[model samples]
Target: MKSNVGSVDRIIRILVGVVLIALAVTNVIGWWGWLGLIPLITGLVGFCPLYPMLGLSTCPLKKRQ
Candidate 1:
């Protein structure tokens, strides 16, 4: 699939994911914090499944042939 995540969005996701994961690891939060892995993986891959389902995209469209 094409990348639907923009640079800024990717950065934010990574940051938030890291924070949440860290909190979970340090026991600052609950196991729920481990869910951060979702955003982390999506951000790293530059693709979001929900984006298409929700009709939202942070990426710029490429010109079609």
Candidate 2:
């Protein structure tokens, strides 16, 4: 898949995902926190399946010659 997530977006997603996972592991959020893995994976992969459906992207545009 094309990388629709930019550097900052990816960083934020990864951070949030990690926080959620941590909360889940500590039982502060219960099983729902495990869902954080979805963001973590998407961020790491630089792709968001939902963005395509929404026709949105955070990636920077490439310069044309």
Cα lDDT of all candidates, in order? 0.96, 0.96
Looking at model 1, residue 1 earns an lDDT score of 99
lDDT of 1 by residue, 15-48 (tens): 9999999999999898999999999999999999
TM-score top scorer = 2
Give the number of the best model, judged by lDDT. 2
Q: Runs in model 1 with CA error above 4 Å?
A: 63-65
| Candidate 1 lDDT (Cα, 0 to 1) | 0.96
Listed in order, each prediction's TM-score against the native is: 0.91, 0.96
lDDT tens per residue, model 2, 1-65: 78999999999999999999999999998999999999999999999999999999999999999
TM-score of 1: 0.91
